[model samples]
Target: MDWMMLGIVLVLVFTVGFVFAPLGLGGGMLFVPILHYIAGWPISGELILTCLMLTGVVSWGSGLVHRREGLMDESIVKIALRGAIP
Candidate 1:
């Protein structure tokens, strides 16, 4: 990818990260589509894995912040993990 495209992708990623972080979302919904269409990347295992990693990081970061603020519910988190883990 060219420098210009890289710049555009970074800007979009930054925007998505800030917008979704507070909502406890990893922004995968936006990232995958943006990467595929804007970056012209093929949708494949690698792309999906990349998005998974990105989302995971965002989740961890946001979760930590919420936990620090005591805004996280332990029981709800466990329930959500049961469905999400598999």
Candidate 2:
């Protein structure tokens, strides 16, 4: 719960988002491990929630660009969401 650590995590999340988002890799893969192992953040609800939110925002930003450029596939999204949503 250190503010400095939280700020660091947020910065890293934003950077990862910028780098990997266009490639369709949400930052979660890197975010979780980096936060847990490198940043020494605990594996807990707050960490998980923060990671998910940041990664999702990054993914959504990239997705919006792709969709606007006509590179997005509606059916593919539907299929993925169908499986991901429960």
Clashes of each: 0, 0
**What TM-score does model 1 achieve against the real structure?**
0.85
Give the per-residue lDDT digits (tens) of candidate 1, residues 1-86.
Answer: 99999999989987898889889878989999989999989999988998888888888889899999999999999999899886
Which 10-residue window of candidate 2 scores lowest in summed lDDT?
Answer: 5-14
Off by over 4 Å in 1: 78-86
| RMSD of each candidate relative to the true structure | 1.6, 2.4
Distance from true location, Cα of 25 in model 2, Å = 0.6
Relative to the true structure, how large is the alpha-carbon lDDT of every model? Answer: 0.90, 0.86
Worst 10 residues of 1 by lDDT: 50-59
Measured on C-alpha atoms, candidate 2 has an lDDT of 0.86
Residue pairs clashing in model 2 are none
